[model samples]
Target: MKLVPLTDRVVLKQCEAEETTKSGIILASAAQEKPQEALVIAVGPGGVVDGKEVTMQVKEGQKVIYSKYAGTEVKLEGEEYIIVRQNDILAVVE
Candidate 1:
């Protein structure tokens, strides 16, 4: 199944969390945190404004950093994903 967000919302696939530390030290399972970065998969059409339509600045395939609790979680095509407003995005990963 496919998800299509509405009105300035975006869908993203959460990136995998780091499994090891910088020094090649393996981290325990309990030390894992949800990855803050994600790959944008889909975006909504521009949200309506005062007699105008403002499109989203983010685009598909862009990697972004978002709030830890930014979006609503859902399962699609047997994989986990999230949907959030463009405003929820903190920054675009280079």
Candidate 2:
């Protein structure tokens, strides 16, 4: 099964959380914060949405930063993914 986003929705695979701090202190699982960065998995074709013409700026395989607390979590075939609106994506990592 595959995910096909509709309208301006986007699919992403989240990057793993860091287990240790920059100072070299190992953190517990509960203390690790989820990273906002993710890899673009799939993207929806952009068109008229909410009466506005939208164009997709992000592409599949691009790393991106998304808004915190955004998107819906999905589990597919033992793999986890995130689905969010294109607007929820903040920036693309170079």
Candidate 3:
């Protein structure tokens, strides 16, 4: 299944969190924090929302940083993804 965002929403795939530290010490899964970075899987078409004209700045394949608690999580085919509004995306990673 694929996600097709409506309005100014964006579909993102969470990037894998680091399993090891800089010192090469492996961390337990329970100790790992949910990563705030993700790859843009799909983008919504720009349109008027909330009485404001919104344009999508992120594109598919771009890595982005979003709010820690932003977006709704969904599981499809055993893979996880997030759906957040365009404004929730903080920055686009170069």
2 versus 3: better TM-score goes to: 3
Q: TM-score for model 1? A: 0.83
Report the C-alpha lDDT of model 2 over 16-40, residue by residue, as the tens digit: 7757678999776567778899999
Q: Cα deviation of 39 in candidate 2 (Å)?
A: 0.6
lDDT per prediction? 0.87, 0.94, 0.91
Number of the top-ranking candidate, with TM-score as the measure: 3
Model 1 CA deviation exceeding 4 Å by range: 28-30, 49-53
Write model 1 residue lDDT over 1-94, tens digit each, in one string.
7898888789999887658788999876558877789999999997694576767999899999998877999897689889988888999999
Model 3 CA deviation exceeding 4 Å by range: none
**How far does residue 57 in candidate 2 sit from its true spot (Å)?**
0.2
Rate residue 75 of model 1 by lDDT: 92
Worst 10 residues of 1 by lDDT: 46-55
The residue pairs in collision within model 3 are none
Q: What tens-digit string does per-residue lDDT give for candidate 3 at 1-94?
A: 6889999999999888767788999887568888789999999997999989998899999999999878999888998889999999999989
Indicate which candidate wins on lDDT. 2
Of 1 and 3, the candidate ahead on lDDT is 3
For residue 63, model 1's alpha carbon misses the true position, in angstroms, by 0.5
C-alpha TM-scores of all predictions = 0.83, 0.88, 0.90
